[model samples]
Target: MTERTVGLMVVAIMCVLILSRGMALAAPPLPPVPADYADKHMPDGWWTDPKVLAEGEKVYMGQVHPKVNCSNCHGKDGQPKKKGARDLRDPSLVNRFSDSFWFWRVKEGVPKTKMPAWKQYLNDEQMWAAIAFEHSFSHKGQAADHAHDEIQK
Candidate 1:
């Protein structure tokens, strides 16, 4: 082959290799949270597990859970600690979302929001526990009054 033709062939090969590597490194897009997720049941009775709820309290309070520090922006009581934080205790807001919606949000985090994905740091069960604890805050007379003191005790 001619020298110029050989050089062009080498350049084409290099470009292909570079593009292939980039595609391999690219992460897959997160799945869209399903519309019918509200009707789905919790895995293995997560809603009724008192132990799971207790463990979730630790995670929410930044105690022994050892993953994301939820209370930094969410406050000990699930109330927002900052200007843009979601008020966890708002019944109207809490009532708007489903359990599956909460689970997906906690796992994936919201775009353009302060929430970060906890999927890397927390396991599925821990995530559910945290959700239960957050849900607890919206119930009347069930606020996390002593959540701040949980770790200390």
Candidate 2:
């Protein structure tokens, strides 16, 4: 109703925005895949398979297993819902990681973070499926080419 009040409200909103942006987590450094998981790869053509992506979506959405709900932290669309959760839609982050790296993260989980090891609940296929789904957010219809490049690296 008053200029002073409105100005103060705007300043408060700005401060909150700045603080939130500052609090958002930066992408963590890529950790090495352990010896056991180093050779692991997603099924050939899994990225382009409609069935695989669909299965992955289910796993990501927590439909396949209660304990395997990636969406709880990573969010259904890959925009993390919780603090410290990585933003899956970030292309820069996606491009930096290989499929095996993603798989290892899913299977083993990141240390000192909320991300838990899914190996106890998800089989290899299911974990790969979930990762494929997460990758879809960044790669979209181009996953085939992206997968090929990552595999070659």
Candidate 3:
């Protein structure tokens, strides 16, 4: 290819990369949990409890509620299966938010997004269980960050 053509291609690739990174970094900030949910938290040790995690996996896969399959969009392994679904495996996105924030999002769903309010089908324990399973994606072998258990007012 001509040098000019090659140079133009390089510039185009760089622009694409830069724009994508900017978009990733521009994710909306976590909205505040409503007063009722702000105080809700997972039961102690729920994050590491095998039984709880198992239950969470069921919830994630939609076994608990036929209408609530998170894997359809979030993927079985936390990678997004659909466009606009956030990658739950990314620690930068998942780990930074408190458990309360995650729980609130699951319960209420994000506005202007495909994520639907799961509260209609999921109770508190089921929602917390699903959040626990979701954390396993980004946290892997790490212990749960107990510090993020509650939302700060």
Candidate 4:
């Protein structure tokens, strides 16, 4: 190709990147981490605890007492609502990080992602329990798009 063509292509690519960066920058920044972040669970220990898993499901599935609502964003059957959220039914992330890291991230929330920290919503026990529940979703055999079942069922 001619040098001019190559230069134009480079400029076009750069413009796309710049536009994308500008779009991302336009969104408001996420909330800062809460002050009480220390002493949370380690990510490795999460999968092994049955109590935490049970409790996590109770909250994640709204089966627990007082019935907190995770079903609004993440689907009731453990699917995420929109594109960017993790599909809890998918397990490519299992054992990907320490169990406590999962707990902390869940408790602390991922900045720039829709995943909210359950810290304010749930206590520590409930937080770890939610982690266990999320891990359990990764072990499932659900169809790719759970929304199909929702409409039919």
Per-residue error for 103 in candidate 1, Å, reads: 0.7
lDDT at 140 for candidate 4? 75
> Which has the better TM-score: candidate 1, or candidate 3?
3
10 residues in a row with least lDDT, candidate 2: 144-153
Full ranking by TM-score? 3, 2, 1, 4
Clashing pairs in 1: none
Per-residue lDDT of candidate 4, residues 12-93 (tens digit): 9999999999998783442333445444443455555666566666787666635466766777656888767666665544
Candidate 3: misplaced stretches above 4 Å? 1-27, 141-143, 146-153
- By lDDT, the better pick of 2 and 3 is 3
In order of appearance, the predictions have TM-scores of: 0.63, 0.75, 0.76, 0.54
lDDT of 3 by residue, 1-153 (tens): 999999999999999999999999895666777887778878899988889889999999989988999999999999999999989888777756777777888999989999999999999999998888888888763436445432343
Which is the leading candidate under TM-score? 3
Clashing pairs in 2: none
- Among these predicted structures, which one has the highest lDDT? 3
Error in Å for residue 138 of model 1: 0.2
Candidate 4 or 3, higher TM-score: 3
Give model 4 RMSD, 1 decimal. Answer: 9.7
What C-alpha RMSD separates each model from the true structure?
14.5, 7.9, 5.8, 9.7
